[model samples]
Target: MSEPALNPLLVELRERIRLLEGGAARVRSALPFGVPKIDASLPGAGLAYGALHEVAGGGPGTIDGAAAALFAAGVAARTKGPIVWCMTRPDLFFPALAQAGLHPDRVYFVESDKEEDVLANAEEALAYGGLGAVVAELVRLPMVASRRLQLAAEKTGTMALVVRRWRRPTEASDYGQPTASTTRWRVSVLPSEELPVPCVGRPNWLLELMRVKAGECAEFIVGACDASGRIDLSTGPAHRQDQAGRSFVAG
Candidate 1:
């Protein structure tokens, strides 16, 4: 005897699953920095999508904080969709973000008085699945909350960036604690390049890869983000340092 006919609904479900699987592969792809040295240091040769990453200033000073925020803005500017920025403070410098290539119009701000609300808003935005990325400025991120954000990002193929901020030096110490983020970075302002004329040249930054999953920690001196959100390798006497002590200068 012949087997029972296949259910039409079941056939449709199978097709949908197949399509989703293909999309998932694309969704989990990496965003390359276009600078070989930096991209090579990251797993998959770039920052992975559908993951949670953390960025913080190297110190509690406003200069370091601004550098860190601009670094994140540059990353978000390169991605495709709208950005959801959740923050407790309303002091984001829009022109600075614009200079970093993240146009103000593409960003949607979720302002709240509490850090908890900011994280909650970020989680919801990540789950929505259509955003380019979700950025949350917080003083502290508990492991449990970070885990939730990571899972949401993985499920929807959205990137989550947590910018750690502190009102005081003591609160900045909280960043030392661990979280579920795939990578953690610290950006510190460095002296700008000396120009031939008596004017300020492009800014520079010391980018420290404090933590990475399945990758070695490294550091690089790089030019600050320009109008197109791209950072060039510093032209200074080139040197490299990794956790393993491997060193090479990329020409």
Candidate 2:
């Protein structure tokens, strides 16, 4: 049977409607982790762009906090263009960030005494567009503030990364509160890899995906960020929980 010819007017009309309604024209973009096991478990097969994500330390220890910061740095490093980092504290070690592939040259730091000011600067940076990412370090992220940040990121297609910190150990419980972030992650320090030499090896981390929008929770015991900001799937027998043995099944 011969197929009927399609209507050009109908096709154009549908396209116009889609754009007007912010449908296909505004499709969600993704940043893949480049690891099949991890990417497969996330929506869009990767981290969604134009959205807000939260990362925190698993414990109150300094090592845990540094791990969380490095994790966020690795994420931002993978992206292109300049970055805006707003923090209440001026304690960021640039040399450590360079090791995670995020160089100080590409970053513009905004140091403020108040957390609210830091968040406001982050929101403004996200809305400015043409940037790679905006990172904000704050102790608490309220639902309303998160929603505002989410909207700003969506408008400019900028990735918003929130690094949650706490002065008091008890305040860590505040992360359980609801927010508009697309995903929440916790990074905990793990023992370093064993080496033939009697010296230290590359770091390892327990990367936990606590909450994800439209996705289940999951965790991975993987090699820590390298100089290029990429993490490797553990090949050691002790870390055989990776794709070689068990695949990443979102829980």
Candidate 3:
């Protein structure tokens, strides 16, 4: 008889390699963002297989919570399943989300009172595996807690978005910036020219990709949101002008 199969440890290693290759293939096929530029900026052209992303703003009246929701919703809308939005505050404007490309019917909202509970619930949802994305709103994220959440997300290949609503700079408790996220972003509303129409006014925002783990940090200006909830690229004067409007002069 030939040598008995092999050590149990060797068998397990082979199986693990097979599973890892399978998972890598799946991740390569998944594209989380409909926006090409944004996708290019993110690792793997989308949210990584297992990672915590943080969204934070300066202070109250910033509407950073809404922006986070919209961003997650937009990604979820492009993904395979519905989105789970867990929040301590009830100010997530569904209309604004609809304006950001997420269908109201595809969103599942879970309201929680405590920040810890919100994080726990989000971890649970991310572990479930069927949801497209999970968003949690909290003020701070501890390293231990984030590690647990990250492990859960990795097991299920789900994306976790954490919204940090810090009112003051000093309130950031966990070391520098108070976040255990793999990537961090700061979003703020920017001034837009007034429009005379009765439709939803021109939407503009200053999106800052403040931190990235595997790539160079960069910033770009994204114009207003249109009816389809897509960012409009023709808002600037350069894009608005017709080809004939340009004056050609000999260099």
Q: Against the true structure, whose TM-score is highest?
A: 1
lDDT of 3 by residue, 100-137 (tens): 77777876777778887787778866765555667787
Give one digit per residue, the lDDT tens place, for model 2 in 1-251: 99765334334533544455444323348888888878877899888889999999874342237788888899899987677888878888899999998999878787878998888788877765656788999899999999999999999788999998888788888989999999999887666777889998887776888999888998887777888888766544463333124433222
Off by over 4 Å in 2: 1-28, 60-64, 239-251
Ten residues in sequence with the least summed lDDT for candidate 1 = 6-15
**Residue 202 in candidate 2 has what lDDT?**
85
Give the Cα error of residue 45 in candidate 2, in Å: 1.4
lDDT of 1 by residue, 133-212 (tens): 88999888999999999999998888899998887777787888999999999887766766879998888777888899
lDDT (0-100) at residue 64 of candidate 1?
Answer: 39
Highest lDDT: which candidate?
1
TM-score against truth, every candidate? 0.83, 0.83, 0.71
All candidates in order of lDDT, best leading:
1, 2, 3
lDDT pick, better of 1 and 3: 1
Identify the superior model by TM-score, candidate 1 or candidate 3. 1
* lDDT over C-alpha atoms for residue 205 of model 1: 77
lDDT of 2: 0.78
RMSD of 1: 9.8
